[model samples]
Target: MKLFRPATLVTLFTLAVSPARAWDYEGHRAVNQLALAALPTNFPAFVKTAEARERIAFLAGEPDRWRNITDDQALPHVNGPDHYLDLEQLEEFGLTPETVPALRYDFVAKLALARAQHPEKFTAIDPAKNKDHTRELVGFAPWAITEYCGKLRSEFSYLKAFQHYGGTADEIANAQQNILYTMGVMGHYVGDGSQPLHATKHHHGWVGENPHGYATNSSFHGWIDGGFFKKIGGVKVDAIVGKIRPAKIVGDPLKPEDLFRQMMAYFGDTEKLVAPLYQLEKEHKLTPENEHADEGKAFLETQLARGGQMLGDLWFSAWEQATEDRYLVTELKKRPAASAETK
Candidate 1:
């Protein structure tokens, strides 16, 4: 397989050393590793190899690495919104998770039309700060997750065709590599969804209302993302490993729309916990030495486990549902005669 080149590895390592925006690199790595643990023994043997495991774990930080490119406006414009979904902002557009479109561009179209019709409901964007032009969007975490799952299924289908038909070793290896890359990168978004802050407009802190008097500290997001864990000693990955259930198919794996609906439900569930997260912070339970520190730790650990379980389920479902690429198989069946005629 085409593993990452030496220079590319160096660059990724450098980027990973920087602070993470969602679950830190360590947390992301844990999610991928846990997912690997969740996979059934009958799944692809190549993926369970030691080298592949390390590759997937390292790649869990890949999407966040894309954010380091400040000079590339296009990169952020496309990649930024995939990491979150501000659920609270949806009501402003008269949309709910159930009502939102499954396709990315379709959702964008609907959001644009809504903004045009109700300009007052949205905040005015300053040209100076809105260079990426993504300020108008809420987020697309569910769509991103669903699309990646579909991509993984496609990879599995083609790999199956390559194996059953006449195909070179290099071709099979490359297909396997593609699957690994997609699985690893997709884990980043899954990890993002597990974080309650990523699901709400109060991601940084309570935004508009003050009925509960939650802390509006901008640092709250960063703290929950990584700092709190750092203070409590890194994510107890081993502690939660046993909690992961075996991977299972999510929705109808053959139907992308079904998977999309499942993702929305997942995000909707996460959004419900946003206020409780704020409540924990307000009670000083998140502090390292507080008497209630263990409670906060358990909450965060559960989120991590949830991400890992969901990721594993998606991967397993993709493998189970992958059908042979019939067109590729038909073409491959002709290859031997074509080569003989040339000879």
Candidate 2:
């Protein structure tokens, strides 16, 4: 038999020690995950989108503040974004904007668009959409299952803004829904943008009939969005927010989602931090409780800080950049044929 050399042994050692399990960090998932926390902060702004405020306040657990809206009104999400905001009538949700409501359900519309365009990718949604007639009071949805997947043909594509845009009502309809239908969907995508596993489907890579201990998607979601973030929560927020400086804008002058896109892109780094943790779990079977409760609390704090900071930057950047567009209304008005949202 050939003698095993030291380098070869080390190479095998590297692979062996490498955590066996991890999820692919697909772009869309990161956006969606970050949306959980983001949508709420963005709630105060956005005048035209009345329903957007309602959902934010609802998630923020101050539904009564939006007194006129009810859980039943929220259910129209099933009908689709346009129908929910356009046809339905909402009152208290819009009072603060101190302006005439313009059916601006960008958050709802964007999600509807995301779901319609790519059902497979957008299925990961806030767990709160379901729950058997009782909305569980929480800041965000639970991981694993959500209303995102169950819906049909609801995804939005921003293809129309492209010059070559063509196709039947179906084609144009889908594309327009993305930017037009919902802008805050930025929150959703920004959230997903941060998860390393969402960047890859290996999302919990093969471990031969056993998942690494201390990990579930909920665990992962919890890690980045929930717990891990708690660790350097104070610090991560500062870091990401700190990164928000004036950069030479690079994107389409007509419809520049570049800022938002870049925010999502930055999340690619989150995967780097999570990979090792998952690898450790796979090889050692580190139960979440063993590693999670106390010691992991620090992990949670740090990761969350990382995620929160990233999240904060994405939100602020998008809002700041979009607001910078002196022609937002003019640009929107230019799309005269484009329909307005309601409720």
Q: What are the lDDT figures for the candidates, one per model?
A: 0.84, 0.31
For model 1, the run of ten residues with the poorest summed lDDT:
1-10
Clash pairs detected, candidate 1: none
Worst 10 residues of 2 by lDDT: 136-145
Model 2 lDDT, residue 82, Cα: 13
Q: Residue by residue across 1-343, what tens digits does model 1's lDDT show? A: 1112122112221221112267878888989998998999899999999999999999999988888777889888888889988877788878888888889999888899998998987667667766887778788889999999889999999999999996899999999999999999999999999999888777665666579999776667778888899887798788999989999889795565899999999999999999999999888898988999888988998999999999999999989999998989999999999999999
Error of 1 at 197 (Å): 0.4
lDDT of 2: 0.31
Candidate 1 shows a clash count of 0
TM-score of each: 0.93, 0.34
